[model samples]
Target chain A: MLNIGQHISQEYNDELEDLRNQVLSMGGLVEQQFSDASNALLNGTINIAQRVTELDYQVNAMEVAIDEGCAQIIAKRQPTAIDLRNIFTVIKVVTDLERMGDESEKIAKFASELSADTNSMGFYKNLKHMTFIAKKMLTDALDCYARLDAKKALEVSNMDAEIDAEFEILNRLLSTYLLEDTKNIESILKVTWCARSIERVGDHAKNICEYIVYVVYGKDIRHVIDGKLQDDK
Target chain B: MNNNKVELDQQLSETVGKPLINGTPKITCRDVNVFYNQDSQAIFDVNVDLAKNQILAMIGPSGCGKSTLLRCLNRMNDTIDGCSITGKISLDGEDIYSNDIDPVLLRAKVGMVFQKPNPFPKSIYDNVAYGPRLHGIATNNSELDDVVEESLIKAGLWKETKDRLNKPGTGLSGGQQQRLCIARTIAVRPDVILMDEPTSALDPIATATIEELMHELKSSYTIAVVTHSMQQAARISDRCSYFHLGRLVEVNDTNIVFTNPEHELTENYITGRFG
Candidate 1:
């Protein structure tokens, strides 16, 4: 969004580009982790869940590298103006993205434990719907960040309500399934935990969207966009 | 005042993308321009305000006309053969360029310190006493002595030079000599002090000492400085103005100017992307 490559120092410009590229790739890795965790639950596969666990290391490493890179730029270049806002936004987004990956790993662990019984999951229909919304929200949140588009970021935040609704339906169905049978109690509880983990991932995506609004408009629209819309009326 | 200032302001004024005025202005420059030899323009319709008891810094790359505008404040460029100035520069709402105003009296009211310390060959005591004597500020020898001691203390140089008051001012170290020059400027009790690269020749510690003096001095006098060090401007100035070529690109609070400059040219200069 900044008039790129026009800074007098080419190395400074290159370093900024490297930071963006690292953050985007980190987002890419987290997306894959979420997707794989979802498929492992739907298909009753333990190997995909194990792979999700292994890929967590890459996301964590990217966060560390990007944090160090941001500190270096602040120290050496003392970047200011739009550059300062953008760097701070990147720092915040990386934290949110890393936590999103952590949530996906938690889901994968539960998926591995419930792998054999996933076909008989009473709330599988609702669980699939919730994961689909959460994963789509993550993808679109990162896209809004990459483009610095506040409107698209607000759209991603709006989609989170859908994930929350589906999660509620899954919660109700899990309670009904547990009450109907005592033998499947352990597997049903694991599925409920997975659904809650996916719901939290959607929340993290919404948080990322709030930060996008901040960096783009220099306005902190978090916790107040709904109130502002009310006031506008 | 120029009858067409409204039209000129529309053509020449550029800001920080926000208003930055504070307090009451001591020196107000409006649509001011400077030219040499009637052909080459050094400053182009610059407008700025030096709020009372605040330090305003003018900064840019070399040959950006910062010094030209500084000299215009005290009419220092009047000594040049082919230089001319246009637009209104007022001190407390009184136009400084009026025909009835004497440039010599104006210099005492609006004092200047140069890039290098140019203390006289006379004794340090005389260098500080010279201004008081010219304006007849003191009626007796002891009165002049009191003024000299007070000025040296204000310039942060009295402790270093009190014992050697009778020695030549030029004999001091480079930083001390600059401080001595500042002491001389203060001896006259000017309303505004115009500093042109006042700390360029000093070491870092000496620069810091002068900067500290500037903060202490601002409570009493309106100070304006033209500096090549962008960091120094950020450190000492309440407000900062960035000049490019012959035009003022941006003027704003120092924090905003350094951390969040509005114009592309100002951002480029402060961020070392200068073209």
Candidate 2:
């Protein structure tokens, strides 16, 4: 990976290892929250939806703890170069994970609202497919982080395009559903919100992947897509 | 310009990063190598430039030859038996090791401050006046006094030591003694000043004072400092060179060296991976 965990100071090594593990644990929690929220939306499961919403506080708490840990390490160690990049990346990843948790909670709240609509079964089918791709992207991004694989992270970053295209198709489909009947406009809007939440989750996952590339390769590929840098225009 | 052709003897001459600057360098080391004995070599093929009016910090682990290279700048290693240097080290396009260039005269042009503040056992005023008097820089007693006062003021020691001109330089605090040494070094009006761990023996406040003084000194003199502390190098230097096992591994801007060094060895050392 980046040749971490071999610091001459054993305590420094342990602290960095702990920080990395904490980020992975936070990533796992975020992934679980997103998965549970997606399942609740697709299967009309209110219990899972309620649990996802409740677990968001834990995510928020983990973010605060990780951020404080980063500050403490920075003050005490004054790290530079790769170690500095690693800590900075962790700080950014924690923020993205917390936002993912928030998005998952939003998805869960919308899941409960759309669960009673038996006429909207086809919309859930489309969301299920989109959720499948988004969830895989999240999982692979976290795997890249755990492995410190910048190439894999770049691959995972590119998968966000799939999510975006799916989002566009779903938006078009929901608009068609809105035109089909004015009576179910409210339920269709809820479904659109859920799709948007899932799309946002994909965006946050892509951000995590970008951060992984930064930490491992020391290259900020945030504005680049498919090996091409985006012009500022 | 005399031709002492720099032959490429080894691959270590390919130092990574921006060792060669676009600006005119006041000092340039082309394929420099230092040897302690027949079997023992201290420095490798180091080619780098020290730009004018800038501080270049050379950093590495113990025995990595940063000090050896710094000593070579003023021919300080000539006192040691069997120590030899090869390749061309030039000061303003003049080869420093040439036979016509006397080492004593060369040192007057390039002064040095050591890790410990070794002020003369003389008075504070005399400590700053020693080089000027030795070089016959001041024509009269009043000129000598003015040189002393001006050197002390430039060294940032005038406010505290103005009243204690007759007192021994050793009687000052650790920081003031180093500043007195700096005043002495600058009294000769050297073109370049070399510092070998000049603040290692001082407290943080003293180190900070010396660092600030170095920052000010760079406006008039080309400065090169060999500091074991990476943070000191990062804080004080405009450019940084990383030495590894006598090889000049990398040389770049201070910000790039501290944050995003191009060489893997530089990154390892900066991140505290091995050394």
Candidate 3:
């Protein structure tokens, strides 16, 4: 973890610590929203699905609050070096977290539509597996952010591939279900939409992990091949 | 963390970034060391270059030898008893400390402004004309008037001080006085200007004015500034050097120094993590 304290001014140290804690607090909320949305999809619970949609406004509010905090730090502290990088990373990570909340809400909307037919639960076995992997990826990415562990961040970022592969398998299974009977096309499409939303959640989790690496190493690893940085390699 | 300190010290035995710029520099200091007397050392081996037509800012904590090194550039430290320097400091390929070189003439080429506004107790016009008259730069009164007006204009004080040319320079505001001092330095047409905390005694508006003037001045002369304000360095300098405990810790482009300094000491200082 980064030692952000040791500033000559204790108040400045407190300000930086408060800023980081605010980011973690926002991450916790977003992670809970994702988990709740995943549970609604797996269990076909309308109440939990509606709850996810309502909670998205809170996530959006957190993004705006955290963005204002960053602007305040830049104005008052004039942070440089790692302090500057950390604030910049927090701004980017907050955006990804908010988008993740949006994706989770999409999953909940589709999950609510698919809840009418309990027989559709059998088709979601593959989606259930994908949700498990994606939720774990998000958990690990948040853990990496809290600890400032670049190595673990890289590991979590690589796990996005596993989520992607699971999505592909789920897509193939859904295609077969569609071809076998045209009667279930409408329900199968909802399942496909839920699966796509889960895949997008994994991508957003990967983005958060990349931002952690940026804060620790002061290097932007986005769009880089194989997740290898120049010095890390 | 203690182990990291040991590793950092080992790394800091030499400068961490490119201190010597490529191409012919306006001023160069090679293997420079300063000593106050036989037993005490004020500066370690520092090798840096001031590129032509750019501003180089030297930044560090108080008593870190940034001011000492700035004084060495113009031999301002020569007045201090028992002070000695060992290095090759050259201006335009000629050693300034050589026996054949006159310190008076060298000072004219490498002029300086100080922390406090120390304009002489003469009129504004005379203060600007003092350097030219002393150096015999202008032969007649009209030529001297031209030099004074041009220097004041270059320093961004002509519009404000033109009507009051006969007023005592000491009667102006702190910022204006500093600008008048700058005009006095440039009156002799120096190739380089050294400023030691030139805006330390001024307000924000004044500091902004001087920073803007420095940006304009860089097109014609090389500038080296010693400042305690890291924001000032970030705003005005093209290159920046970080010093710590009498050692040159790092030197790099101003953007790199502020955003991603390579040396830990520089990072700590700039981020307010310094002990």
Task: Name the top DockQ candidate.
Answer: 3
Q: What local lDDT score does residue A52 receive in model 3, on the 0 to 100 scale?
A: 79
Q: For candidate 2 chain B, which ten residues in a row score worst on lDDT?
A: B1-10
* Per-residue C-alpha lDDT of model 2 across residues B47-164, encoded as one tens digit per residue: 9999999999999999889999999999999999999999999999999999999998899999999999999999999999999999999999999999999999999999999998
Q: Is candidate 1 or candidate 3 better by DockQ?
A: 3
Residue pairs in clash, model 2? none
Tell the DockQ for candidate 2.
0.37
Worst 10 residues of 3 chain B by lDDT: B1-10
lDDT by candidate, in order shown: 0.84, 0.88, 0.88
Q: Chain B TM-score of all predictions, in order?
A: 0.93, 0.95, 0.97
- Model 1: per-residue Cα lDDT over A26-62, one tens digit each: 9999999999988888777768888887889999999
Instruction: Evaluate fnat for each of the predicted models and list the values in order.
Output: 0.35, 0.57, 0.72
Q: What is the alpha-carbon interface RMSD for each candidate?
A: 10.9, 12.7, 3.5
lDDT (tens digit, per residue) of candidate 3 on A23-119: 8887888788888888888875668777777778888998999899889989999999888988898899899889889989988888777778765
Off by over 4 Å in 1: A116-120, A124-127, A157-196, A210-223, A226-233, B1-23
